[model samples]
Target: MISTTVAAVVTRFAPSPTGQLHAGHAFSAIRAHDFARERGGRFLLRIEDIDPGRSRAVFVKGIEDDLRWLGLGWDGEVVHQSARFEAYRGALGALGSAGLLYPCFCTRADIAQAASAPHGPEGLFYPGTCRALDPAVRERRMESEPHAWRIAMDKAVEQTGRLHWHDEETGEVTADPLRFGDVVLARKDAPASYHLAVTVDDAWQRVTDVVRGADLFEATHIHRLLQALLGLPTPRYHHHPLLTDAGGERLAKRRGSESLANLRENGADPAALAEALRRGEMPAL
Candidate 1:
């Protein structure tokens, strides 16, 4: 169990090894690392390599190298999600036994083309099409078809009652997991979804503070709900502003943002870059 003493502050920086670390990643890491170090707290590093098809071993090494280049070191050995499949499976089993999980066979295209589906922060949310399937049919489908597992949002909310979480930026916020409809807990291609894995990992590691970009603010509602369901302690959150380009678009790997390695190769001083990031100075990328 995590030390709950008022002085025991624990934070983490978890990034997927799908690509090189960019300026935005550096900013978030700096914030998380500083928040912990400044307070004499423990800061951890977790590599979220749950997606087998996209995650690469070389990229993981690049992440470590980039963090070191930025002068942000973490406490303890690094935790990798790919190596914790059994733990994730156990979490899914717990939710399944509680009747909170149901098989979701809907593909991304199916959800996108559904005219009735409502839009949310992350685009069109699942419409709970498979939540009402007959137990016999669901069992039969589970036997032969690949399916993701989604939480029964309404049922889960009822079980947990009204839930809320403390955010460093927004203050106390009520958790409305239903906005996500029935969010996936486990994916067909991965052992667990981000929602499930993160909640479980934070609890198991006893993380007391969660520091990440503001883009994930809404996702916290679902996470708070999951914590309540799994009897996990809620961590205080600090959703810092995202780093954007000169054109006002958020820096992203998909957009081919300038990476830390590129900056290093270009002769950018790591210490100077870290200072600029701390001062909120925009990168020339």
Candidate 2:
């Protein structure tokens, strides 16, 4: 029965299966979960397993186990990016039909050597090298070599015009899609790039509030643009501060920091560990 009460608040905790969960992940997950529960909302869990090169089954299992140990549970079945390839492909096609997508044949080295290439928030922004390629040339190269599909940022922005999204942490923010240059939508090895997949999935899943780390604050600008392009509703964002080490370095998996699994194995109490994490008292180092 549709109670017709106020719509339920929806949140999500999306983690990639690249490495074992760490202190930072614990804090983020607990925060998202608690935020939703406190408001009688539903919290979702998404497995960002799009990057086949780095994602692993073991890490996926470890994420669930660590979250459980921290006393966090999500509503509904977990959504896996690997299982949503067709949807991503459709989104790409939609953008392509709108003349907002193009193929790029340049490798990372080629972009680095391009004398006129401009730098943006994400490393060297892609110069529109293939954006003006002869159709025959592009077709030939695409059939013979690897390439990534990138959004025609200028064209896409022109279509959307001036746009803005609200962020709970910073209030209304103007969209700056061009700041990322012509961001990739799909890659050679992967059907969809991180930007494409995330925007498509979030809208599909009806995520109301995005709660994640502050490191992704800049990326939100691109996300706002994608939402406008795809004709999807925008959700509020909350970029929380990251958990840091004793030396003030941020805790991260790639840095080889201790994992939640190791902490559990070392006799860390789940309830107590959760409390300490909430209070920012854990990880004395």
Candidate 3:
């Protein structure tokens, strides 16, 4: 049994092994490490390599080396999402048995065409195409064809209460379900989507806190709802500011942004790099 020690605040740095760790990644890692140390807590490393198309072993190794060079260490063995596919599938099966999930046959173009009206964020919102389908009809379609699985938002909203999380930096907690509805739990290509993977991993690792970027603040509501639906404990959140490039755009691996490796290659000091990240400055690459 895990000890209920308030002295130990468990946190995790879950990075996708799709690309190199950039400045923003460093900033979030250092912040999580610092928070854990400050409260005498535990910091864990989790590789979110569920994306089979982009995730590579080389990138995962590079992330490990980069974090080590940054003078950051995590507790216990690193957990990889790819190895935990069974757990995600089990969770999905549980939800499906409860009639909370349905197979969605609508494609991107189909959703866009349905919402010929206006939408927000990514694009046209996901119409409840599959929500109204009878169980027999859905089962027939599932046996005859392939489709992505999506959670039923109306049922989720009715069964679960409002979703909310405390933001450490902002010191303000927010809750809004309308902003997030019927999020995809699994894709056609990958059985598990990020929402399911993250929730399952956090629960398995006993993460008490999650430290990530401010950009994911809104998405926390979706996660919280999933946690509630799965009957898992919700972790505290700390969404820190992001590091941007000279063009004022967010730093990304594909953009050739300053990475921990590039800084180390230039003989940059780890302590200095950590300090620069805290000050929101791009370390010398």
Candidate 4:
């Protein structure tokens, strides 16, 4: 059993630098900071810039500006995911050596077509096209192809008797791989997926707790599996409620609604903004 009274709860605010910060982002950042401050712990800021195509320096600067404007302070220098590709590669190589990583060659169209044929999720549930290749065939493919990397769930399940984690807010958590199946570890284009990047970053930073929006509750399973596979300590998760718009849709930076920048432009008070989000008020975008 994990200890309840954390000696030092290290939390983090990891935001992708692909877009601007919105009310939801502010709420989560403040909540994480407050949680760490309340426990006399460390609050970290990490840049989730794995998506090199979309992540930009301007957006990163925007994030720092926004967080500072919200009166949030972090403990150390901000960590960027793009600079940690070698670490991700090392982890992937470990998984590969353990026979727990496999290359996926299925394209978006192929996955989509497969999914449509099976009437499943938007994309193919990874038909395991490259999973069962013979050693020689796999070697030949690896020699000639560029493919995404996927965790071999069967091997992971065999290694770890059961997958489970403790959420700080939700309590005891468990997941069955039979339901979620294998998840991608790295894309061919994007070296690190969100799950892989987050798990590695948390472990690297010695984060003891994670506080984010409730929308990612299901992703806890993926993180749990990654932690077990990588032999990294699991942090307590606290998933807070999401801030939504008046239309009841979740606010997104890409959608250009209820962004902190816009709120500030409209002369919205930071204190009042925080209170409004806490009270679930749809801020005027």
lDDT of each residue in 129-216, candidate 2, tens digit only:
9998999898988888898999999999999999988877888898888888999989978889888899888888888889899998
- Residue 224 shift from truth in candidate 1, angstroms: 0.2
TM-scores for every candidate against the unseen true structure: 0.96, 0.95, 0.91, 0.91
- Whole-model lDDT for model 1 versus the true structure? 0.91
Alpha carbon lDDT of each predicted model: 0.91, 0.88, 0.82, 0.80
Model 3 lDDT tens row, 168-195: 7876565565555677899887889998
Tally clashes: model 3: 0
Q: Considering lDDT, which of the candidate structures 2 and 3 is the better prediction for this target?
A: 2
Q: Candidate 2: count the clashes.
A: 0
| Candidate 2 lDDT | 0.88
Question: Which tens-of-lDDT digit does each residue in 1-285 have in candidate 4?
Answer: 223244688999999988788888988888888889998999999999998789899999988988887788899899999999999888888788898888887777876666433432222466666787887887888788888998877778888778778876778988655445557889888777898988888888888989999988887787888788778888888888788777888878667765677667778788777776566675565
lDDT of 1 by residue, 1-285 (tens): 434344578899999999999999999999999999999999999999999999999999999999999899999999999999999999899899998989999999999888889897668888888987998999999999999998999999999999989999999999988788888899999979999999999988888899999999999999999988888888899999998888899999999999999998888889988998898777554
Instruction: For model 3, name the residue pairs that clash.
Output: none
Clashing pairs in 1: none
Question: Which one wins on lDDT?
Answer: 1
Q: Which of the predicted structures, 1 or 4, would earn the higher TM-score when compared with the native?
A: 1
The residue-level lDDT of candidate 1 at 45 comes to 97
Candidates in descending lDDT order: 1, 2, 3, 4
